[model samples]
Target chain A: MHWKEDSAEEGDLLRNALAGCEKAWADLFRMHYHRVYAFAFRSGLSAEDAEDAAQEVFVKAARYLETFKGDSAFKNWLYGIAHHAVMDLLRKRGRREVLLERLHENDTTSKCSAAAKHTEVGDVLGQLPDDLRMAVVLIYYEGKTHKEASKIMDCAETTVSWRIYIAKKRLRKLLEKRG
Target chain B: MKDDPIEKYLVKLEVPTPQQEAVERALHRSTLAFKNRVEPKITQRENTVFKWFEKYYLAVAFAIVFAAFASFFPWAERVCPAASETSDLLAIYSEVKMLFQNNLVAVLLQGSELKVQLGVPRNVAGARVMFVEFSRGDEKIKVLCLEGSALRVPLQGKVQPVLEAMPTADGGVILMGDSFVWSRAMPQTINGYNISARLL
Candidate 1:
C-alpha cells in the first residue's frame, strides 16, 4: 500500500493492523521507519538509541491502536508516539549536557570532504532550541508543511511558523559567529 | 532549494536507516505483543456482565420508558426505577458513560498524578450536565449527573471529600459539597436531593 497521508486519514491501515494483519503491520513499519528514525535522531538520540526508540514506539502504538479514535492524521498520531519515546530517552540520559555534547559531535565527524561544510552547518541546527529544531527538521528536512508540523508537535500552526522563523534567525547568527 | 544553506545542511544530515533484519525482528515481536493485549480484551468483553449491560442497557432503558408510558401503576411515575432499585450508582454511571462517550469534551489537567477527565453530556433531562472520571490504577470512579435525581456515592477508606463543583450557567450542576472519595456504591443517599445534586 502506498499509504498517502491523505488516504490514510480514514485509518484503514491502522484498523487492519489492529486486527492482527501481519502484512499491514509490516507495511506500516516500512512506511514510518525512516521518518520516525529521522525524528529520533534530530531529537538528539544516538543511532542505537534512535533505532530502539523507533521499535519501542511502534510496539506501543500497536498495543494502543484501538484507542487511536482517528481524531487526527495517522502520521500526526505516530509522531506523538515518537515524541514521547524521545522524551523518555532524554529523561533517562539527562537532558541538556548530553544533547549539546552529541550535537557538538555532529560537527566533527567528517573533516576532509565536501560533507564537512554541511556538518559544520549542522552545528547551528543542533544549537537551535529543541522546539525550533523540531520545526526545522519536520518542515525543511522531512518536507512537511508548517500545518503538518504543528499537528505532529501538538502546537498551533502559528507556533510552528514562529519557531521556524526563530530557527532561521538563530542559524544566521551562528553562521556569522563561525565566519 | 539547493542554494539554501539550511537546506543543504539538512539534506546532508546523516540519519541511520534501520536494517531489514532488525526491523523484521521488531515487527514480529510487536505482532505478538498486540495479540497478547488486544485478543484477551476481546474475549474478556465477551464474558463480562459489564459488557452485557453495555450492549443492552439502551434497549432496557427504552423498554422501561415504553412501559412507563403505558401503565397506570404508580411505580411507572418513576422513570428508571429498575436502575435505581439496584442502588448501584457505579453501574448506572457506566451505562450513561457509554451512552455519551462521543459527546463528552475531555478536559485535560496538567501535572496531576491522578488521571482525571471532565466533560459535559450533550443532553440530560433536557439540560446539559457535566461529569468527571478519576482513575488510579485498575480502579476508576465516575461522578456523573443523573438527570432529575441524585444518588450519594460513598467514600472509601480514610479519604475525605475536598473539592466541590459549582453550577454552570447552563443549569448543569457539577458534583458539589465537601469532597468525598467516590470509590464504590453507597446504596443509600446521604440526602433527598436529585441524583444531579448528589453527583455534584
Candidate 2:
C-alpha cells in the first residue's frame, strides 16, 4: 500500500514494527524495495550481488526503523541505505585494480551495443561517487526526470541536474581515457 | 576521420537501462527481508501510565505552566511494556497499524503521527483486555508538563510503563507517571478508533 507516514508516523511505525507486525513491515518493504534494488544494481552489483545487497538494505532498514524521520521521501531513505550497502559490497570486493580493469573492459562493452552491458556497466556504477552515480542511474538509466530524481535523491533539482551533468562528463572522460 | 574520434565516440555512447524487473524482484524480496528482520515482540495486557498522566501532575503542570509563562518547557512513557499475551498482542498491533494507515485522522493531521503500544487495564489484577496505546508525536510538551499526574488512558488493558512517542498534537497522549489528571467526559476512542477505552 502507498505509505502515508502521517498515518502512524515514523515513531509509531517503529513502535508497531518493533512490536512485530509482519504485514505492516512487509508493506513498508514493498513501498521502497524497487528504488533500493535498482540503486544497488546500478551502483555496480551483479544480479546476484544486487539481490544480496537489497536484503542487506532491508535488514538495516528494519533495525533502524525507529530513527527514520520520513522527512524525505521513502525512496531517498532507501537509496541512502542502498548506497551504504553497495559501498560495503565494493569494499568487500577489495580487488580495486583488478575490478577497475574489469570495469574498464565493461566500459568498453557499453561503448558497443547494450549486449554484455549487464556485467560491464554494473561494475563501474559502483566505481563512481555515490552522489553522482545515483543521479546518473536515476536520470538516464531509470528514466526519471530531474525533479523526480531530486525527490528520490532528497536534494535540490539543481543538485540532481549537476550530478547528472558531472557524472556524464566523468563517464565520458573515463571512456575517452580508456580509448 | 572527419572529426575527433573521442567527441564523436562520446556522443554515441548509450547508458544501459537498469532491469526494472530486477527492481521489482528486489522490492518483493526486500519486503520479505524486512518482515524477517522485524522480530515481533509479544504484547501483554500492561498497566503502566502514558506520559500525559503522572502523579506529579501538580508539579508537572506547575512546572509546565510556570515554564509556559517562562520558557514553556514540557516533558515523557513508561518503558516499553509488551502485552502479556504475545500472540494476542501481535494480532492487535497488526490490526491497529493497519487501521492507523487507512484512517482519515492521518490526512487531517499533518506531521501528526501515531505511537501505539498494547496495555493492560489498570486496577485489574490480570485482565486480558489489551489496550492499544496511541499517542501523537508532538505531545512532548504535555508529557513534560503533566509529568506529575499519571493520566488515565481510556483503553481497557493495563498500561505499560514506557511507550516511545513522538512530538505531535493531542493525539490522545496518556501519562505514565504515578498520578492522574483526566476525568472521563464520555467513553471515547484513543488514537486507534478500533479500540475503546475508559477515561479515568
Candidate 3:
C-alpha cells in the first residue's frame, strides 16, 4: 500500500517536473542523487568525479524530460542517464585502465594480511570488468531490482540476472581470498 | 541471492555520497539552468489575459459563487470552495451539486449544439461547454464540460456518463457531469461522431 502511494506521488512529481515545475525537478534531484552518486563511486570514480557525474545526469534528465513518457519507473530512466555519463567520464579520462593497473600494483600490499584484504574490497572491485562491476554495483550496492537494472544497463532482463549471477561468483572468489 | 557472504560484503562496500552542500549546489545549478531555458515562456505568459485567469481564476470564481449564495443561505459562505489547485471546472462542480450528473450529450462541434434526448438517461442536458481532446500517438482523451460539471472520455468506448442530477430552485432540473479541462482544441473529428468542426 505504501508502495502504491509512493508510486502515485512519483507519478505526480514526474508530471509536474515535465511540465517545468522547477521545485518538482529539484525535489527529484535531491531524492535520487545518492543512488546515482553511489553507482558512479562503485564504478571506481573519485568522490569529485562521482559528484560531477551525478549532477550532469540530473541536468541531462531535465533537458530531456519531454522524451520521458510514463513508461517505466523514473529511477530506471535516471539510472540510464547516470550510466552513460559515468561511462563517458571514464572513457574520456582513460580511467578504467589506470584504476585496474593501480589495483594490480596494490596486490602485494593487499596480500599481507586478512585485515588488509578485507579493506581492499573497494579496490578489488575496480579489477572486475566494467560490465560485471556495474551489474554488481547496481544490483547489490544500489539495490535495484534485476528488471530495473536491465533497463538502466540497456540489456535484456535475463541478461541482468545472468550478470548478477556471474558477478556474485566472481566477487565471492575475490572476497574469499581477502578473508 | 540471499544470505550469501559475498553479497553481504559487497553491500558493505564503502561508496561515496554527495555531501549536503554538494547536493544543494547541484540543485541550484540545475534549477537555474531550467529557469533560464523557460524564462522566455514565463515572460510571454506574464502579459496574457489567460495568465491572469490561470492565476486568479479560483479566487474570482469563488467570489462570484459566494455572492450568489450569500443572500439567503448563511452556510453557503462557510462551505469550503474546492481548492482551486485541481481545475476551474472542478471548483464549479463542487459548489453546484446539480451540475454533477454524468449525462452524455453527443456534441456536434460544428453546430455548437449539444443534442439532448429529453427524457432519456445520460442522453442529453443543457448549457454551453467546451470540450478539449488531448492525444499522444494513438492514445486520446476527451475532457467534456457542461454548465460547471465535466468528465473525461471513457477509454472503454462507452458514451460519457452523467455525473449528477438535482432540481434547481426554479422548478427545473439541471443535469451535469463531473469533468472539465483548462483548455480545448477541436480535433478534425471525434472517432465515432461526425461534425463540421475545424479539427487539426
Best by TM-score: 1
Q: Per-model C-alpha lDDT, please?
A: 0.62, 0.51, 0.61
Model 1: fraction of native contacts: 0.37
Q: Which candidate is the best by lDDT?
A: 1
Over A90-115, each residue of candidate 3 has an lDDT whose tens digit, in order, gives 77766665565435535643322343
Candidates sorted by lDDT, descending order?
A: 1, 3, 2
Task: List the DockQ of the predictions in order.
Answer: 0.19, 0.11, 0.18
Q: lDDT per residue, candidate 3, B1-200, as tens digits?
A: 75877776665566533567777777877777666542224444466886888899999999998888785687756755643323554443333325334444322111232222222233334644433343534454444344333333343344454434333454333433444212123223333532111111
- Could you give candidate 1's per-residue lDDT for residues A1-179 as a string of tens digits? 33334464335766687677777777777777778877887676665677788888888877777766566667778888887787788668754665565555555653224445434544566677677877888888777888888888889999999998888888877877877
Candidate structures ordered by DockQ, highest first: 1, 3, 2
Cα shift from native, residue A126, model 2 (Å): 6.1
Error of 2 at B134 (Å): 69
TM-scores for the candidates: 0.50, 0.37, 0.49
The complex in candidate 1 yields a DockQ of: 0.19
Candidate 3: deviation at residue A73, Å? Answer: 0.7
TM-score of 2: 0.37
Query: Model 1, residue B12: what's the lDDT?
Result: 71
lDDT tens digits, residues A40-138, model 2? Answer: 656655445666787788877876664555565555566667767777786676535435644565656453255354444544454577678777777
Best by DockQ: 1
